[model samples]
Each structure stands twice: as structure tokens, then as C-alpha cells.
Target: VANKGLKDLKKQVEGAAQDAVTAVGAAAQQVVDQATEAGQKAMDQVAKSTQETIHKSANQASESFSGFGKKLGLLK
Candidate 1:
């Protein structure tokens, strides 16, 4: 009877340990998901800013190129 009681107690402890591990894993996954979402949001904002910068730079470069072409008598 004592040996059987010890076996039951061991099983209960093992089960609780497994449950705790599963909970930790679930919490970590939630954190990772949230972080990924935040990172993607930040990346999107950066991309927008970069695109705007590139567009402005391209406009300025084209204007300069057009001026140069006019000076070279290639364009009116």
C-alpha cells in the first residue's frame, strides 16, 4: 500500500511539471507573436519613410539631369 501511494504521488508530480512546462511554452509563444507584430508595424513605417525619401531624391535627381541636358543642347 505504501509503495502504491508513492507511485501515485510521483505521477502527480510529473503531471504538474509537464503542465508547468506547457504553460511556459504557451506564454513564450504569445510573447513572440506580439513582438513579431510590433516589429512588422515598425518595419512598415520605416518602409514608408524610405519610399518617401527615395521619391524626393529621384525628383531632385531628375530635375538636375534635365537642367544638364538643356545646357548640353539636348533638350529645350
Candidate 2:
């Protein structure tokens, strides 16, 4: 009877340990997902800013060339 009781106790302990490990694994995965999402957002913002900068630079260069062409009488 005592052996049976000890076996039951061992089974309960193992079940509890398994539950804790599963909970911890789920929490860790959530953290990793959040970090990945945040990194992607940062990269997207950087790409947008870079595109805007390139557009502005291209406009300034075009205007400068147009003005130079008029001064040289190359364009009417």
C-alpha cells in the first residue's frame, strides 16, 4: 500500500514539472515574437526615411541643373 502511495506521489510531481516547463516555453516564444515584430517595424521605418531623402535629393539636383542650363542659354 505504501509503495502504491509513493508511486502516485511521483506521478503527480512529474506532471507538475511538465506543466511548468510548457508554460515557460510558451512565455519565451511570446517574447521572441514581440522582438521580431519590433525589429521589422524599425527596419520599415528606416527604409521609408531613406526613400524620402533620396527623393528630395533628386528634386534638388534637377532644379540646380535646370537653373544652370538657363544661365548658359542652353534651354529657353
Candidate 3:
């Protein structure tokens, strides 16, 4: 009977250890997922900002050229 009790205790300890490991792994994965999501959002913002800058620069260049053309009497 004592030997049986010891065996049962060993099994319980092993099961608990496995559960702890699984929980730790899940927590680590969650951290990684959050980090990846944050990085993607930052990248998206940078891309949007870059597109806006390019659009603004193009508009400025077009307006400047139009003004120059008028001054040269090449455009009405």
C-alpha cells in the first residue's frame, strides 16, 4: 500500500510539472504575438506617412511648374 501511494504521488507531480511547462509556453507565445502586432502597426503607420509625404511633394512640384509656365507665357 505504501508503494502504491508513492507511485501515485510521483504521477501527480509529473502531471503538475507538465502543466506548468504548457502554461509557460502559452504565455511566451502570447507575448510574441503582441510584439508582432505592435511592430506591424508601426510599419503600417510609417508606410502611410511616406505616401502622404510623396503626394504632398508631387502637388507642390506641379503647382510650381504651372506658375513657371504662366510667367514664360507658355500657358494661360
Candidate 4:
């Protein structure tokens, strides 16, 4: 009988199939996680640079306004 010749073959095939599916799923998940992490890091760097630029511009604008205020006798 074929079943007698391959008594445990069905179970073995099922286990192998399960392992292959798990491996593929893990690989795909890893790719998505890495991409997300990279995107977050890039966004953080851009935000920091923009903040620095805005801070510098604000400082310069405040200094210019103060100088004008002193000329107008509005600031000591």
C-alpha cells in the first residue's frame, strides 16, 4: 500500500511547508521594519536641521529689531 510505504511522509511534508512559510514571512517583516526605521531616522535628522535654521533666523531677527528699537528710544 502507498500509505504503508510512506506512513509519515504526509506529516513531514506538512511540517516542511509550515517552516518555509514562516521563513518567508519573517524575511518580509524584517524588510518592512528596517525600512521604517531608516525612514524615521531620516525624518529626525531633517527636523533637527530645520529647527537649527529657524533658531538662527529668529536670533538674527530679534537682534535687528532690538537695534531699531534702541534707535527709536523704545528700548534701553
What TM-score should be assigned to candidate 1? 0.71
Ranking by lDDT: 1, 3, 2, 4
Worst 10 residues of 3 by lDDT: 67-76
- List candidate 2 stretches off by more than 4 Å: none
Choose 2 or 3, whichever is better by lDDT.
3
3 versus 4: better TM-score goes to: 3
Residue 66 miss distance in model 3 (angstroms): 1.0
Please give the CA lDDT of all the candidate structures. 0.99, 0.99, 0.99, 0.97
- List where candidate 3 sits over 4 angstroms from the true fold: none
Q: Give the C-alpha miss distance for residue 56 in model 2, angstroms.
A: 0.9
Model 3: per-residue Cα lDDT over 1-76, one tens digit each: 9999999999999999999999999999999999999999999999999999999999999999999999999988
> Clashes in candidate 4: how many?
0
**Per-candidate count of clashing residue pairs (backbone under 3 Å):** 0, 0, 0, 0
Query: Candidate 4: what lDDT?
Result: 0.97
Candidate 1: stretches off by over 4 Å: 60-76
Model 4, 1-76: lDDT tens digits are 8986586888888899999999999999999999999999999999999999999999999999999999999999
TM-score of each: 0.71, 0.90, 0.92, 0.76
- lDDT for position 54 in model 2: 100
